[model samples]
Target: MNEPISWVVAYPEIFLLVMSAVISLVDVGVKSRLRDTTYVLSLLTLAVVAYLLGASAASGETLRSFNNMVVSDPMGQWLKCFAALAMFATLVYGRRYAGDRDMLARGGEMFSLALYALLGMFVMISGHNFLVIYLGLELLTLSSYALVALRRDDPQAIEAAMKYFVLGALASGFLLYGMSMVYGATGSLDLAEVLKAIAGGEATLKGSAQVLVLGLVFVVAGLAFKLGVVPFHMWVPDVYHGAPTAITLMIGGAPKLAAFAIVIRLLVEGLLPLAVDWQQMLAVLSVVSLLVGNLAAIAQTNLKRMLAFSTISQMGFMLLGLLAGVVAGDSGNMANAYSSSMFYVITYVLTTLGTFGVILLLSRNGFESENITDLAGLNQRSPLYAGVMAICMFSLAGVPPLVGFYAKLSVLQALLASSHPLYIGLAVFAVMMSLVGAFYYLRLVKVMYFDAPTQTADIVAGADARSVLSLNGALVLVLGIVPGGLMTLCAQAIAALLA
Candidate 1:
């Protein structure tokens, strides 16, 4: 008999969908009465969804629904919870910034669209079917494109949106074509069935192997664009520089966790048999990203653009953990390797949230804080904000006693444990690139601390943003000091995924 379908497995997504629609309608009615009402409602919605995810994670049981197209598991639940929390923190940092710039003046569209994007991320995390995953990806990307152009009056924002849309559509096409090829090769869209076909051995020696490999190439290309790695990273700097600071934070922060989840789901879960092929490709990509991303970032004067390049290099470190997962086809180290990547991604996102949060906090109406020179003498203006930004920069530089250090160390450990000469060399190169990257981050710190104030205007930010920014920085430090718990959790989640 077929297994009974359970809608309860998708309760969090269902709730978010319904609440998002309700909030959209409610915004039309109550937005004029109270300017911040929709914001409060959006926060409450995220809080409830987070609670549901937490409860499910605590249950420690995987549940599937809709013919296993949707799954509820510890990995998905935890990622979803964090994604929501990141969105919450993003809104907290963005509200005042948005209000001053007239982005939040009309209604709750900004909040609702963000909620929709969160809903898309949740679906992406839980989706077990290729079609479902694609659907979720479209939802997220479309929302992102719209969010980027929210400031329609700005030519830069509109131009950025056009570039994003054109490139995004092409990437989607690449992914879809790849998916079609995979389906043709395996005669199944279901990942498990495709795996069975590949593992069964008849498919590899046949004519289908070539097609499968070709499809894999396109898929990886599409994914690399999303990850903003070098050679596929042209859009990142433009988008980051063009969009408003608030939208930039939204784009940079939580979506990365979603990207990591999809990579795990599609590559690691669905296509492990082809690791040798993709591993080589990823090795090249990682090296190029580290080299180009770090070198390019050093020349950028715009803080947003510089961070965009920084993100590309950081993704290289995350890829190192991924490539370490399969050495000589020995699957014994897969869980630890993948878990390290997960931990790296999560920590990177956490650090990114705080870093961008500080940027947003420093911004005010009519004055965009896009230039690194704008940060001159930040310490003199607001010591607390400057300190938070410093912590974020230090963490990103992999300085000792910060979460980024531990995150990078874990990935390097995974690479070293592989006992491969090539990987060992790559790790050494990564360390060197990191040292180069540190010069820029530390240079920014020097400007904030030692340089004279460029803008004598007083910096004003609310209590909520200040408090959350402090906590965000503290977590980065605390997690570095005691990373055992999060590391174990990531390991357990990856183990469950493999099982």
Candidate 2:
């Protein structure tokens, strides 16, 4: 018998879908230069969706609908709410930046596309089935490709879009192929069923565990690509540098939370029986990502590229938390481990918004603020923005009195709690790489505070952007000082899932 559709559980996604379509359709009637109407409508839609997500979470029960293809839970709701907030902030920060650059020329494509991408993220986070997850991923990737190519006149943007499309398609193929193998081995597309089959040792395939393990390798590689880890991270710097700053913020900020969700869904939720196997793989990837990301970042003169490498290293730290969850037959700390990663990702995204927001703030028409030298004497131009950017940089470097520091601390604590020699070694290595990474971040601070101004123009931004950026930076510091509330929320969400 088919399960009754629980419309209330998916109300936010439904609302977003309707609003996205309406905005797209309405955009046609609106003229090209007046895209602010679309932007305003999109932001309103996100506000409503966030409210709906909050309401859903307050219901306090995990709700599954459509034959368990979708789930509404505290974790998904919290992640979705934050992602929507991130997108909302991104739009506010990008509006003038995009307008000044004429990227908003095509009526409402950019605004509508962002809404669609947010919709895709909502679907990805809530999906409980393999096909549903893939569908959501495709939607998000396709929207992102269009967004990157928004400035069709710019060859760099077009090239970045092409590369993103090709690489995204390849990753999608790997993920789909791996899912097929998993389905072939487990005889199910539902995550819960796959977990049941694997844990019960009833997943009968031609080669049994070997086939599942092979599928896992492909799956992890696909995920690594999305997360922009080393060896699979060739596209990150190019894309971030090539894409407009607005689009870069769109790509870098919220999709990461969705990626974390899918990893938890596919690996932690479904294939936990093979944790022993994937743990080794993730451990290796983590160490390599940390080493390569931090080392390579030191050589980058471009701020975007440096931040991209920094993102790669940050992801490696998040993976450490994920790896700490399953330790040689002791799943007792699983909730805490995953919760730590959750906290880390949430805080990382918050910091990324402010970091990129500063970049966007410094940018004006026909002038892209991409180079490290571009920030020279920024303190002389605007002490406030320089402070904001400095806070973000320090936070990313995991400095004290900042949220990023606490995020790293929580992840390391999770790893050390595992009481495993290998994890301990990884912890030591990660700390050392962090120190190396600090050089670049501190270098930016020096350039901003110490170097002479290359351009003497005033850093102009809207009140909304300035206010939001200030709040974003302030949150990084406030959360670091008092991280207990958010961390406890994450812990409760994860613990509820385990329960």
Weakest lDDT window of 10 consecutive positions for candidate 2? 203-212
lDDT, model 1: 0.89
Clashing pairs in 2: none
Tens digits of per-residue lDDT, candidate 1, 165-201, equal 9999999998888888888888887777778788786
Tell me each candidate's RMSD, in Å, in order.
1.2, 1.1
Which candidate should be chosen as best, given lDDT against the real structure?
Answer: 2
- Every model's TM-score: 0.98, 0.98
Question: Which pairs clash in model 1?
Answer: none
Clashes of each: 0, 0
lDDT for each residue of candidate 2 in 1-499, tens digit (9 for 90 to 100): 9888879878888889999999999888777474866877998998888887877766667989999999888999999999999999999999989988888775668888999899899999999999999999989999999999999899999999999999999999999999998998998999999999998888753457777888999999999999999889989999999999999999999999999999999998899989998888888888899999999999999999999999999999899999989888889889989999999999999999999999998998889999999999999999988998999999999999899998999999998999999898889989999999999999999999999989798778888889999899899989999999999989988887777
- Superposed by TM-score, candidate 1 places the C-alpha of residue 433 at a distance from the truth, in angstroms, of 0.5
**Model 1 TM-score, 2 decimals:** 0.98
Residue 409 in candidate 1, Cα distance off native in Å? 0.4
